[model samples]
Target: MNIDPQKPLLQLNVGEFLDLLKNSATEKKYEYGLKGLAKMLGCSRSKASVIKSTGILDEAIVQNGNLIIIDKDKALQLLAQNKK
Candidate 1:
């Protein structure tokens, strides 16, 4: 690549920059905390906690200190399998 002092090195409009950001990033596919899980599951927070305690979602659950995050798709799949 040759350096060009007379010409602009790069050019991007705001919309193009935003689109690039959107396409370049991977979105998180998990839910945070029991409340988030409840919202995703369409259940009460207490119910989500109960489900967490059952260990049925163990494979989908991630715990860091007191914070809990659940992989939404995996949890739903596990629940569906459990129902069968």
Candidate 2:
């Protein structure tokens, strides 16, 4: 990494910094288990299981044995892409 002292770094006010943090935190929410996934998708557990089996959201899914975790934003994006 090269440091360029001549270039000033970006600055943010306290409110702007807080807003950025809040947006970042909301942007990458994780949902755990089938119930959580269903809640995230606004669908039933059965439908969520079916969607999981389709493998369309595989990139957003993390599984270990019986445990499942989903990246809500990524899954929603994938679903939106597939809706087209």
Candidate 3:
């Protein structure tokens, strides 16, 4: 049996990962925490720290807990405007 080396060697590229993250953020239906968002965004909890520091995504307060997800409207607006 031949094994495919490319399998598992191909993690989604940053742009692809970011696009997925944006889409997921746009579809959020419940409260999520920073760690949760980090996990969902394909970043290790450590990497999430870096991403948040970079401000591509931000933390928001929801009710009594913390929610961490991208701003869907802002992301779509930016994508829309940059297309021109």
C-alpha lDDT of all candidate models, in order: 0.84, 0.83, 0.51
TM-score of each: 0.66, 0.66, 0.35
For residues 36-67, write the lDDT of model 3, one tens digit per residue. 64655566778756645654443332324353
In model 3, which runs have C-alpha deviations exceeding 4 angstroms?
Answer: 1-27, 59-84
RMSD in angstroms between candidate 3 and the native structure over all alpha carbons: 13.9
Go through the candidates in order and give the clash count of each.
0, 0, 0
Q: In model 2, which range of ten residues has the least summed lDDT? A: 1-10
- Residue pairs clashing in model 3 are none
Total clashes in model 3, counting residue pairs 3 or more apart in sequence or in different chains: 0
Candidate 3 at 67: error in angstroms? Answer: 5.3
The numbered model that scores best in lDDT is 1
On a 0 to 1 TM-score scale, where does candidate 3 land against the true structure?
0.35
TM-score of 2: 0.66
Query: Model 2, range 1-84, lDDT digits (tens) per residue?
Result: 233445444655566667666765744489999999999889999999998999899999999999998988899899999984
